[model samples]
Target chain A: MNQIAQEVQHQTHTRLSEVSTEDLIVDIHGLKKYYGDVKAVDGIDLQIPRGTIFGFLGPNGAGKTTTISALITLAKPTAGSGTVVGFDLHDRNNIKKHIGAVFQEQTLDEELTGLQNLKFHAEMYFLPKPVAEQRIEDLTKMVGIHDRLSDKVMNYSGGMRRRLEIARGLMTDPEILFLDEPTIGLDPQSRANILQKIKEMNEEKGLTIFITTHDMEEAESLCDQVCIIDQGKIIVQGTVDELKNSLGNDFVIINFNSPDEMNLAMNLLNDLPEVNEVKSSGSVLHIGTKSGSTAVVKILNTLKEKVEVNSVEIKKPTLNDVFLYYTGKELRDDVADLSDRLKMVGRKKGRRGMMRRR
Target chain B: MYASTSKSQDSYNGFGIFTFIRSIWTVYKRQNARLINSKSQLISIMIMPLLWLVIIGQSFNNLLGSSNPLFSGNVNYITYMTPGIFVMITMFSSLFGIISLFYDRDSGYLKNYLLAPISNTAIIFGYAMGIYTRVFIQVLLILVIAIAIGANIPITVGSLTAIILFPVVVSFFLSGLAITLASRASNVETFQAIIMPISMPLMFLSPILYPIKALPDYLQWIAQINPLSMGVEGLRFVLLGKIYTDGAIIDIAQFNDHLAIFNFALLFLVGIVFLIMGSKTFLNSLYK
Candidate 1:
């Protein structure tokens, strides 16, 4: 009995040590939030592992911001709880010490110089002046804003302000950083620069980033794992390659001699059990199935026996298709519509109220 | 690698009470810097009140003169109006505290403070202290002008202490009220709508321009109940050696002792309650 107990204890210790290495930096369980009658976030469960770049993708009104707000202790969750860096979200005072956030809006003081802005934040986190100064210098250099540190933020361009905002988020040297649509309205070059800095932060410092965006290209290039949410619920989540592979084998598209021949080709190709979906548009017959090369060779050989084949192409699935397959709609469709109502209603109500009061 | 680890460890020495206090002090210093930087605005804020003291005080002299019977032995209207004007300055300065808060919230700068590791209590107290500092300077300037204009304030040190404490107490009272209003305000318009009624009524009902005893029983009850009345009366007792009475002139010496203790306790309790409620509301409204 003594010998058996000793062996079990050794195994448990080894397992515990391994588990510590894989501990999640952010663990959210069954979190929910409601805005009056609208359920903004309904029961979201997510686990972001330490030292990984995680992207949260969702269409408008999909509760992405609500989830981020809950995680950062900005908004209270109506149900369930989440932990950031092993600190409870409900216990805001403790959780605030470990997490840094850049909000959707520009949260910096526009009237203050960049250096002063950083200094104020640093002081709030209680870093000594010398330490904060050094960190600020390093952060400015990292974000490529070191040259404009003395200029007031009001004088800076949108891109410059965003870069400074990112640097401000890093002032506390957080283990987990949350960036909500960090590159929303920037020009292409500025967006690319900001994305590169985020990548470098993850690579060099081993920092865990939880970034939310609807930009498919950004998630494909930057995130190690991506979760797609729609209608206040997470539909699917996995690495980019895993999600794409889950769509099932590659596809082969063959352009026929005529539009009439395309339907005939699709009809013939449907007989093959390996073929998943065969769609014909105009003179093109698009076939999605396993073993693309073999299917293409067989289809070409069969087509030669009947009609002519003009061109053949094989392409891999992309993140765009993955998004469409999960959400049943294009990601970009009517996203700005959510904010459009707010702009119209908020302004009209505000104006009418003001006039009546006056 | 060594440098990086050291930096990371240093960053984790998170904020405590002392650090929070230091941060508030830094914010207070910055507010003063901005006030001083705007030379014209600073001069105007100081001059406008002195202007009121001279012009309005002189214009209302007949209405406030001893022939009115309410004035009795106190003939000078400037001295009578000085404390009221001082209270007005205090009201204006404290009201700025809430306006600054609303501006910060609208412009999104408040988000940075909200996300910081500091506690909500720290933010409320810091802002209150900062506003009180401005009120302190304004009160001092008014005191100097009052002395120069022949409004006699007792030269004794105890009387000076009471005069100074008067503004601080009024500041605490108004700061609490301002923060409470600021926390509930969704926008500047909403805030203005809410504060105007409260501030206007409180100003008129208080014993600022007139002594409480001169009013009828019902109005006298309202004036006596007003928090501003306690402050204005306390200031009068300290400066002019006057006693507050409802029917007859009470002993000046005994009235001073009673008013001092009562005002101090009331202001302190109100300040604490306002700070707690304001902080709680402010934290809840942070994300919404």
Candidate 2:
């Protein structure tokens, strides 16, 4: 009895240590942010692994910006604490060295040329002049802005400016980078170009990237893991495949010849212990189970006595289905009209009338 | 793939103080490049102060007659107003430094510095130094114009050194105040609204256009308490070699005590206090 108790205590300690030492590059625990009456980030916990692209998905006013801002030291977290690259967020100066951020809004100096802007950023990071020049050259080329290095940023296109901003964030040679809605209002070509560059940076440079977006397709394509947040809480989080697989096993969809056949198939499959859910849509039958092959065999063998089955197909779950299951709402349901969303993003950017204001 | 080069580079042998000063110098160089690169604006900025010295100085010459014993004893009105106007121009140019903070905040360029690995105090000092350099240049240009316009300006080395140091201190003071205001302000409109009232009252209350002793007793008390008034008086005392009086008209019998040592010390003490207060406000505003 004494030996058993000691073994149990040792096992518990080892398990607790394993849980605490998870491969989390950014560990946020019970983070709560309040803006007067609004709890912008309400008791949220997140863990992102090193060298993985983590996507934060949420709609507007869902605390995505606030959370990112707090992580990057642009805003202070009101309650709990977190560490980025082993430095506390409250130690902003130390954490800044390890993290680079591209804000939702542009922060480049239009009066300066693209090269000059990068140089300015490099100097701010205390990079020596020669190293800064070389890094600037490499980054501008990486972002495909090398040709326009000498051109004033004011003369560049919107896509060009966005690219420059991303390249500027790399001047510090940070271990982790945060991109907040990086491609919110860009044209498809520009968005694709930016996304490709981000991918190359992560793959080639081994940089950890934290991307926040409302676009499900972007998250599914770029992220190694996706965390869906709603009303300031993370509803679910997992890799794209893991999240989809968590929903259920393969669904064998059968379209019968008649409604009576579908009803007959459902009645037969419902009694089988292997079949989890059997629902009929008109003449169609959807049989969800742990084993698709075995369930199909049973359904067909039993259907031989009832009615003829015209066609059957098995479909795996998708990110869309996973999102729908977790949030109980379609991903694109609240997506603003294209032009209206563009206008809203543009307003937040505040780049159009900057020169006039100065 | 290029393997990582983990070899540490030797620390360069350079004067640390010189490197720090050079950093500030480079920033000033960029500021000058930015200012001079805009040809029309640069020309207008230089011409505006010269034009003000000529036009406004001439118009206010008669209105600002030497009825006061302080001016009648030594120099003409233009000579008397030259140092005062120089200090006023310094104050105005320093106020324009507010726009730099505003532009940085709006463009998110300020965040670039805030997010840098450097100390927050360094960021504050760098910006303050940049604004101070610009105001000093403007002050220099105004002094040149004043000299050319037959405004009897002192050319002593002591006065020149004082003029240079005056702007440095005043700019540091103003930049600290500007950073505090800019940090709390969400937009340019609210910033302008708050600064305008503060700037106007400070100008009126300070001894910029007239001697402080010329005001009523109650107004004198207000001016005595105003920080800008102390700054103006200190600048005058330093540049014109004028004795500072504490709201009392100078008479021959009272000449020994006419120059109040207490008021001179008060002015210097207030300037130091404002600088400390401004820096404290700046650091507090950083997190907000």
Candidate 3:
């Protein structure tokens, strides 16, 4: 962690000691939303602390968007309950006043100038004219779009439009901001720039941000906490370090010359005192263990006698590796299935063959 | 808690009727801005009425003779067709307003209004008001064009009021019909496909291009019941104080108030019914 991140962590620890239910900006339990027999968002729970960036990581149609719609009052829940920003879930207007959302799609009016879009949002929220004007100016400058405020949105580049959307979301000085794939299609540089701005917003303003993204790297680099959801259920959630640590502290892979040798080495490693589990693919064997530097020597000593190992390398667990360990599938592989299920949900909701996310 | 750094959460008084009106007004302003920005579309719509008054009016005047017994003394065909043209403008304006709804839907901008704190009724009312303003503007332009083309339209205070307010009511009813169709359509193509056939028949079946008495008996009955026909007759009464129907010139005051109050009441009632139906369907399409 960097110095400021460590300082933020220190503050987080101190606040956790005195944290009450009110400290959770978003608190929900057993939330469910069903379309006919399809449980688009099945039973799920979340308790996100204030001033932390939380990532809801999931593949498309894994209920990330559905859950957001339910919380933001775009969809009605079939069961369970929740509270957001000290208001009940059904208190939609009050909750909307305290929370802002940037949808996955670009929802800005292309014909309107960037400034007009921000002012219109303020009008919808009933912000006083003078207060709205000041915030609009401040937020545009913060997102670095103040100079282009007079240009129509259609004339904006994709990154500039995304920044303006973020600025608009902050126009009401909302307590919590919800971003659905905030940087999904931006270039690498733009993506990094937006992520930096998101982190800065969370740190400087103590804004509780709830983000959902399919990008694991974004979650790993930017989120203070993340939850992996699949098939409408949360598989795992924790701090980045904790989730990685949960999948064993180290991974040691051994490459053998033959399948016979790989099986023999896997069997030998199973009996070793330091190794936890051995998984084999092709001619290579992956061994999970703790204190990998020290354990590597002992594992090699045990294997050197019975097996002919071609090469051995030690690896650290990443968020992707943890996702694989928990979900038993690659994140990108399920995208094809996402569309079929989304269509089914749309049809069940009586939509006229349009793929409306909510 | 992070409340220390958080902005103060002002106590929210729940939305009242005034809040509802405010939201509608804001949406109205937004629609007006969009309409103003698209100058080409505005000019294109204005040209349609000009064509009707100049080309269609003169051609029919030659075909049907310059002096016809069906019209009041010395009144030409163009003067009689002007009110019908205004009704046509109102119909087109109201229906075209919902085309923007489809664009809003495709562009995802509709979600901004849908997710806003305002009720669906407010949004519908706002769109209706916007369409009304467009229809009013187009009618005024057509009136200027007609007068410039030598159509004799009387300009009394009552007639001026009717010209301004009558089209607003007619557009309200048509706007509701348009919204009802838009709520069920999945895309712009389907909406245009469905609206074209319905709109063409309504226009031809009404008395926009010719007198209703000239149609066959069954067609005349159909034209008489058309909402556009009611609007045209009311406008004709206010603008001319009489109408040429059934080969006779009947004064509205002597012929009972059916030309003014009766038709206005009918149009108002129809507008309310369609507004209710349209808003309900549109709201249903929005929510799960």
For candidate 1 chain A, the 10 contiguous residues with the lowest summed lDDT are: A1-10
Residue by residue across A99-206, what tens digits does model 3's lDDT show? 888998889987789988988887776777777788888889988999999888979999999999999888777788999999987999889889999999998989
DockQ of each: 0.40, 0.30, 0.41
Ranking of predictions according to lDDT: 3, 1, 2
Model with the higher TM-score, candidate 2 or 3: 3
- Which segments of model 2 are wrong by more than 4 Å? A1-23, A249-317, A331-358, B1-41, B65-74, B181-183, B213-217, B242-288
CAPRI-style class, candidate 1: acceptable
Proportion of native contacts in model 1? 0.46
Native interface contacts kept by each candidate, as a fraction: 0.46, 0.43, 0.45
The CAPRI-style docking tier of model 3 reads: acceptable
Give the C-alpha miss distance for residue B23 in model 2, angstroms.
Answer: 7.7
lDDT for position A138 in model 3 = 82
Which model scores highest in DockQ?
A: 3
Give the CA lDDT, 0 to 100, for residue A92 in model 3: 75
Clashing pairs for model 3 are: none
